[model samples]
Target: MKASAFMYGLITGSVTAAVTILYSTPQSGSEIRSSIKNASTDMKHKLYDVKGKISDLKDSITHMTKEVKELVPEAVHDIKGSIEQWQLSTEKNKLRLEKEISAIQTSLAELEQTIAAQQK
Candidate 1:
């Protein structure tokens, strides 16, 4: 008897819940279906647009990497040539400065000798 009572209560509760759901819904079944379909279509278009943008980005990155690989070697070669040229130019100036310093030392020595002779 207790089991039969429990079963009856369950059925009654299920039927009342169904009727409440059917009457309380704001949109009809057809309108809900249409809205869902439109939403799915919009989502697909957005996904395709995102996919195209990613492909374009990948292509641009690949092109830039290729350009950097080509330019790096050329830039390094130019820098090496510039350094060698600078060293060559400075070598001539260094020799001339050394000669000038030696000449100045000799002149000072001769002046000191003349002053000592005059004192004597």
Candidate 2:
């Protein structure tokens, strides 16, 4: 049982008990009938209002779910593309750095050979 339904039942039970007590007391029949009619009308209106709110909430949730579904795939695709570009650029930079290091090593070896020849 839903919490709202349980609470409504509790309230209805309490109201029924109260009304029964009032009816048993020395009140006019006309007044008792009028009270019962008013209570019934109020209960019906409250139930209708609750139903309307639940329907609106359901609609709002459905709309939000659809919007999220539409956006998530596009967002994932954009992120994947960005990561691939970054990886490609990093690989290119690594290759360039390696070439620079090799050039520096070759220059050092040539300089060492020139110094040895000069010493001789």
Candidate 3:
């Protein structure tokens, strides 16, 4: 049972105890029956209230799930695009560095040839 139901039981029990003590006499059958009827009505109303709250909770969860499902594909697509762009940028940098190294090596070879001729 919910906290509210327990609270209701406590409240009803306290009230009944107080009333019976003050009266100091046994209740008639009709009085007992009426009190029971009222208690059942109260409990029934509380149960319905609890049910409504639970239904609202379920609806909230379903809505959140749908929103997440919709967002997942968009997030994946963005990540894939970012990865592809990163790979392309890395390839371009690599090619540029290779060309620069080849040019440097060629300049070094020409400098060495000139030095050898001078020595001879």
TM-score of each: 0.57, 0.56, 0.49
TM-score computed on alpha carbons, candidate 2? 0.56
lDDT of 3 by residue, 1-120 (tens): 999999999999999997876477477767877887898999999999999999999999999999999999999999999999999989988899999999999999999999999999
lDDT of 1 at 118: 95
- The numbered model that scores best in lDDT is 2
Residues 1-120, model 2: lDDT tens digits: 899999999999999998789868776878877988999999999999999999999999999999999999999999999999999989988999999999999999999999999999
Q: For candidate 1, lDDT tens digit of each residue in 80-114?
A: 99999999999999899999999999999999999
lDDT (Cα atoms) of all candidates against the true structure: 0.93, 0.95, 0.93
Distance from true location, Cα of 44 in model 3, Å: 1.1
Model 2: residues with Cα > 4 Å off, grouped in runs:
1-20, 23-26, 94-120
For candidate 2, the 10 contiguous residues with the lowest summed lDDT are 23-32
Model 3: CA > 4 A from native: 1-26, 93-120
lDDT of 1: 0.93
Better of 1 and 3 by lDDT: 1
Model 3 score (lDDT):
0.93
